[model samples]
Target: MQIKSVFIVEDDPSLQSLYEKILSYYGYTILGVARNGEEAVKMFVDFQLKPDIIIMDHRLPVKDGIEASKEILIYEKKAKILFASADKTIKDAALSIGITRFIEKPFDISVLIENIKELIDVKI
Candidate 1:
C-alpha cells in the first residue's frame, strides 16, 4: 500500500513545519500537525480523513508520546506510528506499545525520508 497521508505530532513549531513541508514535497498529503500528544489524539479521532502515517515525538505537553500512541492504538490498531525522539530511554517504552519504527534525533533528513518511504511501502 502506498502511504499518501501523514500527520505530525511534535511540540516544536519549526520541526512541525519542517516535517509538513518535507513530507508534502515527497507527495504525501498532510492530514494535519499537532503540538501535543493530547491534540494529536484528538485530531486523529475527530478528523474524517485518517492518516496513513503519524510522525510522533516522545516528549510532549499534556501527554507523552507513549500515552498518546496507546490511546490511538486502541482506536486504530493498525496505525503506523513512527516514533521520533532524542531520548534513548524511550525505545523500550515505545516498542512495548507496538510502535516498532523509530527515527533517532539528530538524524539526517534523507535518513528520515528513507524510513518513512520504507514504511509506506511495507504491506504490514
Candidate 2:
C-alpha cells in the first residue's frame, strides 16, 4: 500500500507530538505540523506536495479552524480535512464548509487511524 501523508493543525503541543508519533507508527507520513489556523492555511497553500489528509482542531490562536478551512478549500476544493475538535457545536458549520470528516476530541487513537484510512481510501 502507498504511504499516505498527513498534515496536523493543532494548538496543543502534547496532542501534536502524540499524533505525529501515532500516525507515523501507523505508516502515514507526517508531512508537517501547524500550531494555529493561520499557519495551517499558509502551509497548506505553500506545500510543495500537499498532504493527503489534514487533522484540524477548531479552537486555536490567531484563527480558528473553520475560517482556515474555508480559505484552504477555496484554494483547493478537494482538500481532505478531518475536523478533530472538542467543540461539538461547530460540527454543522464544519460540514457546511465541505469538511466531510468530523472526529470529536478525546477519541481513541485507533478510531482516528481508522478515520484517516477511510478518508484516504475515498476516491474524491
> What TM-score fits each model?
0.94, 0.97
In candidate 2, list every pair of residues with a backbone clash. none
Give the per-residue lDDT digits (tens) of candidate 1, residues 15-108.
9888988888888889999999999999999989788789999999999999999999988888889999999788888988988598789689
lDDT of 1: 0.89
lDDT tens readout by residue for model 2, 1-124: 7888999999999999999999989999999899999999999989999899999999999999999999999998999999988888889999999996998998998899999999998977
- Mark the regions of model 2 whose C-alpha exceeds 4 Å error after superposition: none
RMSD of each: 1.5, 0.7
lDDT of 2: 0.93
> Which whole-number lDDT from 0 to 100 does residue 39 have in model 1?
97
Candidate 1 residues lying further than 4 Å off, grouped into runs, are 1-3
Q: Lowest lDDT 10-mer window, candidate 2? A: 84-93
TM-score (C-alpha, index-matched) for candidate 1: 0.94
Q: Count the backbone clashes (under 3 Å) in each candidate.
A: 0, 0
